[model samples]
Target: MSSQRSSKTFLQLKYGEALDTAATKKSITSLLSSHDGTEVIHHCLKEGARWGMSPDSEEPNTLEAVYILSGKLKLHRPNEGSFLEAGDFLAGQPVSEFIVLTALEDSEFLYITSNPVFHYYSSDTRNLEMLAIEIEKKDGYTADHCFRIKELSMLVGEKMELNSESLQKLHFGALLHDIGKTEVPESILLKPAKLDEEEWTIMKEHTRYGATILRKTNITHFILAAEVVEQHHERYDGSGYPKGLRRDEICLEAAIVGLVDSYDAMTSERIYSKARSKESALTEIKQLRGIKYHPEVVDYFLSVIE
Candidate 1:
């Protein structure tokens, strides 16, 4: 099942490519993943630096996601607005003749670009992010639940030796897995009270709704993510989910997310439950084994946790 690991390439943003040479500049960009016209990049920007997203450049039509990897910087509307600290993601298309960046300090970013899908999925992708923020606002404990799931899912994905495309899909799948929850009524979503059987049934439909939303968005690349979203609540033993999918029937990414989702659920406090100790959570996960999760996935998850 192993494939040739994609080569990671280093690239320099030219005078007008990523940095406005006319303005102050110092920056570096690395290519992380590229498939189906999308490129994932790692960018490092230094102090007193200014970068440009000129609509007249080589890759001008690119849709980009800039996630601050480290350090801090003031960024918003090329020359206007406030600072965005590390961990914040800025997504958009080139809106002005030249959108420039001024670094308040040395900063790094993770950029995801897809010339094709960016046009269609850009707004939706960012919208989902906003929804995630709303979820955190509604439940403070889940401040970065989607991000955590993406991180943990990627960790498991790497352990499984997933190819670059799979990893990318897994990453998106993990991030938007809970987007369907947006449809759930706030009265039930933020009830702070035990949900009755009907409510529980409605809650379980989030997976189905999530899958539908991903597909309906016309994000062709996200079809994989759609599958993961739907199957994430499924069990290896044919018990979990709206579909009762069993072993091997569920996609690998879904299984990975399912295991981690449960792990995180057990270890993190939420509107419905209190957090379990790490050891206690791990113990419960271990006990589930072949019952709740895929055996190989469980083994890999256990190995990573230990």
Candidate 2:
């Protein structure tokens, strides 16, 4: 898609043509943009995928409208939910809260916003998504692992009744938590046996590496995610690695990710460990509630999974 601007009064876009494009698994293409921060974007989302919108300080007072092109979507706010189908339109002005859209089926829509989000969606967010792909390719067993963590973590976040901003941080942070493993050598990442003490040491560095990777983006959301990635390995009882942050020392977002990450790891088939049953994983997680995990986080997580 060409992002070139035309000095003419009008520009025509042909079928399937986009002015600019960005994506992870789902995609967003900028169809038009204005200097005043308005944008018309084409968004595609896989069934069950979620997208969040909130008015932040950088773009407060932003107004948005969604015109569903196909499939089904659900709009979720604090206490109410509404469903939209093809030809349905939803619009609202900026609010102090967040609104989330979940694709009930493979869905496409035209997202028009008064404030600019093209750069964040196109650049920073796209970069992070690409990094996730890189991690999947680097370790074969990690296919969709980060994505699953994100989904489950969000469930827990929602269950915990976290505020809008915290949910956003949790969403992005969970997806990028293992991004640091990209820096680890393939030998250790793919090794079918347990990592030796030295190899384990290298493995532990991924938390810091993930933090570094996210910090370089310089985006507030991802910067906060970096903190989650850095501390996700820290234990509630101060027995975990990197910083060994205990209990309240670990951010709630990291604690959420850490708990979900551990559960996902246990339930996933790995080169070093066989997949554990859901019941088994839950049993272990429940046992370590206050020791390996935060007590509040464990309660909410159990509620989400159950």
Candidate 3:
């Protein structure tokens, strides 16, 4: 297992390579490009002082560790803005109102927390390694499934011209949509044949289970991600469940996830059924477009596979 210190060093090295320029007018946007992997674990970045203010509604209880790598920043809490210089390290129980503002010169900082207020990024190597370990532990196939679905979903999202931020959410959401299945019964999940009605009902609960699990993280992105997990099983015509949300009732991110998830399920070999050829799966998806899946999403997937 990687130690916290090693993880921090890895993050620092990655961040440096992406944001080392000293002369340019650096903003949160520039900083984010270097810290893309970490974004899934954190929420939005505040650029300069223009809009990087913290939430003021309620005080947070989790702890946050901030390590400054370069330049300077004014840390604003409810009462004051404290100036923090490079090489400074601060740790505090989460405050309801806390924000960071970068100085005119380029600045860098690392934010770490166990609470789920932001997104965490994992590179392909990390994701694959984690999946391998999960498989070794005999957890299930969900992790491996997530990895492929994320790749396919991103491909479709890019072809559809989704903005960078939305694309990132879609990618992470796909990986996590079935995370709730962790609460499901292993026998039902790995059954070699079809599920009985009772088993099917239990299986369906995975969505709600996933959402609930993510909600405990207290991260805003996971909140959005939770919604995706809850609604990924919902159908366009209002026949799907937990909630039978219809049409635009479902979030766009959830819809993207739903489409890719279905595609993967149909195309991949499972314990219950043999995998369909990609062509056959595409044909089925095309036939169900608009009724079962979003038409635009279907079109994008087709374009990519073609």
Candidate 4:
């Protein structure tokens, strides 16, 4: 549809007519941004198509109904991907970071937008950094430790060659991995000796608490990062924490953060343990392989360090 014609503002849009011009990219890119008073739109796509959209930061509130008229689509945002089939419908101010739409097969969809239920701040890292500073205050070492993990996790992610969206989520998630520990008692967190089973239980609860905080923020980016926060402790062989989720059940970003976190903890001094040589930590992690860490993540991590 021609932008000039579409701009005429007709009461009705005929077939093949689009309220907003079709935005295309080699893969994914931003499709829309802030505009004047309530404007509803319709988009149509053919097979092998992809589109990404972001809401206005100043007015983050938006309610939308998207119906997949035909074919299949993979909607990716931040750390999650949603598969929409023909007849599937999604509603709400449902965008964070951005919405990625990819046609798995020949596809077409219709969307209607309206006022949103509530407004939320757009993506920002400064707020999260301040929160991290506060959470890390309890332990002098962790401030630097978390940053190291973040660097290594992103390095691993880059080795794996993740897309920008995946890398962003991985970076933030790795930095916030231990944020949940803030909720636990310092007695258990700062103990110089091994934690008793009871104290260990409280330590384990950090994942749940951390994810809860991210979810409560209602910010798309952090909300997307919550998967890593909650699942970083889960093991590849179904043996790790708050949940025993195994294999692909764990989010890849979370697994990467977990592996890096473990690697950093081993190499860095902590109140409860002596620092191990980098070589030793690498050897120990290599031994765990698929048993403790995701095999692909381990391999990529090794390549990154090597």
Candidate 5:
């Protein structure tokens, strides 16, 4: 509900000057036109790109009609999946289940919706970005930590040949992994020595906090990031907090973030621990491969940083 129909009766938007715009690595969305809560959007997706929407009960009554203007697509929903092609149309709302569209090839589409979603999505992304900045500044030991993690995670994702959409989710997941730490006390966050058992327990709750913060946004990308944030601490050997998921039970994106986070934390200065040399860190990571981190993630990450 961030945008409303303008008072003016008529308007014109040039091809290059869209009303609103947003993009990810695999797709670009342009708010080409709007009228009385109805939004006409233009989407260009790279081959194999994917878009997902999860159920949200708090959302206003909303519906969407998508017309595939060009190329092929596949629709995936609970217990059903179908293919789409040029001129095909589908309409529905994610009221109680998840919906996903995957581009079978380079494609273009028109998405007409009763909800003016672009504004809300754009606003949420901006606000969350600002929040990430604030969170980073709040933690003295984590200066630029999120940024470094994001960069490293992307490299590993690329080395592993993850698609664009997966990479985008990994990007935000790594950048906001520590957002839950905002709830921790400053005394504990800035403590000069190692944390006691109680403080460690509280610190471990940051993953849950980060997941909750993201889910509250009700945005698809954030929802994916929330999963990664929550599970990033879980070890491959099933020794982790909040959940004991191991190996394939963990999200691949979360596994990547966890590995990169460990390496970065090992090499970065912290109040309680001295920075380890990069060689020492890699050696330690090698020693723990398939035990603390996913085996494949460790292989690619070591190759990337090497």
Candidate 6:
């Protein structure tokens, strides 16, 4: 008998030839199918492992989805490549009619394809309850802060009549604008004394650092959020950095974040500074309206606070 048939027969006899093989197979398939459509995929690919078609390989036109379950994978194209980590998703065309994948670690992934041309058996959500757990694991403080900022940003963004998509972006951007601060030195970040000029300079780099960190991820949807991080410190008249974007030169999203960020900073107690009264904070923001902040943004913030 053929080897495949012999193997099947062995399983059948072992489990009992009288048993329903089809039902057994169905149950197994159902268990494996549990990964379908979710970010977590179940396949183990170890580090330094390499697989791909040759340079002249005729690639198939297919819709592919990859989700990293654990560890990492480096997907290489002719001119570009990326490292994907757990929870990252990539849905795009293969590069140069060929592609290569190298595991960066012992990684698990869920890979799905619709093309019958290349047969390689190598691959890889949950509701809010699951999402909360996921976000907590990812970045707990930032996730919670973002949820609050999104609500506030939405109120301001909607008043501006931003399109639904732009409003959504603004909401998300506000929440993520300070995410880069994660990389800053904890001593500097939590310092109770005034930062020296050198310390201040280092602190300012958080914006650029934030943008760079997010740039390395597959979360292109957060690009605007990254930009907001980079520009939130910029002033209306001109004095901001890493870029001194002025007036309309700055993204509106950045302007919104700056306004709200200042409000939050003033109202929240810091080691170096006691929290100001709400009325005092509002007065200070109003004083800086046309000089340090965009007039329209200041107006909207004032309306919200009132």
What are the root-mean-square deviations of the candidates from the true structure over C-alphas? 13.3, 7.3, 11.5, 13.0, 7.7, 17.2
lDDT of 2 by residue, 140-226 (tens): 555567667877998888777676557777887887788899899889988878789999999999999989997876555666678
Cα deviation in Å at residue 207, candidate 6? 0.5
Instruction: Give the Cα error of residue 231 in candidate 3, in Å.
Output: 0.8
Task: Give each model's whole-structure lDDT.
Answer: 0.66, 0.72, 0.57, 0.65, 0.71, 0.54
| Per-residue lDDT value at 3 in model 6 | 12
What tens digits encode model 4's per-residue C-alpha lDDT throughout 78-140? Answer: 445568997898765634344446577766666555432112112233445556655665654
* Candidate 1, 81-105: lDDT as tens digits: 5566788876665322323344678
Clashing pairs for model 4 are none
Provide the lowest-lDDT 10-residue window in model 5: 6-15
Determine which window of 10 residues in candidate 6 has minimal summed lDDT: 5-14
Cα TM-score per model: 0.63, 0.72, 0.58, 0.61, 0.64, 0.55
Report model 4's TM-score to 2 decimal places: 0.61
State candidate 5's TM-score: 0.64
Assess candidate 3 and give its lDDT.
Answer: 0.57
Model 4 stretches astray by more than 4 angstroms: 1-124, 140-142
- The digit string of per-residue lDDT tens for model 5 on 1-306 reads 112222101111111222123232456778999999888988887775555444445554667677899988776543445788999987766334444566779888887877667665445554555566566666654545666687689678766767544655686688788888778787786777788999999888989999999887655667767989999999999998669889999999999999998898889886567899999999999999999899999999988899
lDDT of 5 at 174: 86
**Candidate 1 deviant stretches above 4 angstroms:** 1-42, 45-123, 136-140
User: Least lDDT summed over 10 consecutive residues: which range in candidate 4?
Assistant: 1-10
Which is the winner by lDDT between candidate 3 and candidate 5?
5
Q: Write the per-residue lDDT of candidate 6 for residues 1-306, one digit (tens) a residue.
A: 111111000000111112233122100001133233222224555554332321111333434556677887666543456678999976644322333455667666665543322111211001221233233224313323444454466567655645433543464456556656667677677676788999888888978986776555423234434677688889999988878889999988788888887777777654456778999998998999989999998898778778
Candidates 2 and 5, the one with greater TM-score: 2
Question: In lDDT terms, how accurate is model 4?
Answer: 0.65
Best-fitting candidate, scored by lDDT: 2
Question: Which of candidates 3 and 4 reaches a greater TM-score?
Answer: 4
Per residue, candidate 3 scores C-alpha lDDT tens digits across 1-306 of: 111111111111222123233233223322332242332222222233111322322435545466666766655333334667677876656423324343434466666554433323324324423433353224334435655676577667655656433544564477577777668777887776778999999989988987887676554444445788789999888989888999999888888889888887778665556788988988888888999887777788888877
